[model samples]
Target: MTGKSLADYQKEYERIIFFDQPRKDILLEGLQTEMEKQFKLPMRSKEWKKENQKIIAMYRKIVITRTL
Candidate 1:
């Protein structure tokens, strides 16, 4: 949560998923699967609470820099 809305997460998620393969067919559900694998924890897990801000900032940077 960390003061960021779901929309923010969605926007970042979209950019992260499409950064490498913009033409690929990546569903929203697939993003969730990938994120869980990447973060090594479920979204609902307490670990995400502490890492939320860092994760958001990281993805925002990736989107801004376009350096996947």
Candidate 2:
């Protein structure tokens, strides 16, 4: 029941968006790593376009909010 406050979490998230590199870059890199593990691929290829699109779409849907 004890952890970082909502504001602190939101700040961290925003930092990732603003101070960090482009969101797409981060998302694609992580997605590529995961897809590589799941599919045993050595690297992302043109064939993975659809999977990448789906992952990016889902990533955009995530919402972070603050309540206080």
Candidate 3:
């Protein structure tokens, strides 16, 4: 996996938050796909556990911040 930088995520988060409801849903799906592609691990695998946690945490943070 080519580790993505914090800035890359921050930028995507910003873009997602700026989108309207329908677009946001689409973007989130795309983001999830991108994450899966980047991680290159099946969702159920033990190896994916830690990264998945981090990704979910970061996604929540972005959504929370957007609401603020």
Candidate 4:
């Protein structure tokens, strides 16, 4: 976050998150599905609060725009 913009970080985040699916497909064989669910469960809750909400929302917007 020092020299990079949120958009750049968002790109990297997307890359890592996207990379995870194929990695899990090859390595974990769906075993970590529950773990991923557990991890995402609180992301929309009060766990992250307002600060991260802005960032995540921004990332989601970027991803949505890219997909469309």
RMSD to native for every prediction?
10.7, 11.5, 4.8, 8.7
**TM-scores vs. true structure, each candidate:** 0.33, 0.31, 0.58, 0.30
Model 2 spans > 4 angstroms off: 1-21, 43-68
Q: Largest TM-score belongs to which candidate? A: 3
TM-score attained by model 1: 0.33
Compare candidates 1 and 3 on TM-score and give the better one.
Answer: 3
Cα shift from native, residue 63, model 3 (Å)? 10
> How many residue pairs of model 2 clash at the backbone?
0
lDDT of 4 by residue, 1-68 (tens): 13445565555455544554556243332323332343342545665645466555654543443322
Residues 1-68 of candidate 3: C-alpha lDDT, one tens digit per residue: 56675568767877887788777777766665665567553646666666577765665564555322
Query: Which of 1 and 4 is ahead in lDDT?
Result: 1
* Tens-digit lDDT track of model 1 for 32-51: 44445565544465656566
Better of 2 and 4 by TM-score: 2
lDDT of each: 0.51, 0.42, 0.63, 0.45
Which scores higher on lDDT, 1 or 3? 3
lDDT of 1 at 68: 29
Clashing residue pairs in candidate 1, if any? none
> What count of clashes does model 3 give?
0
Scanning candidate 1 in windows of ten residues, the lowest lDDT window is 22-31
- Model 3: lDDT to the true structure: 0.63
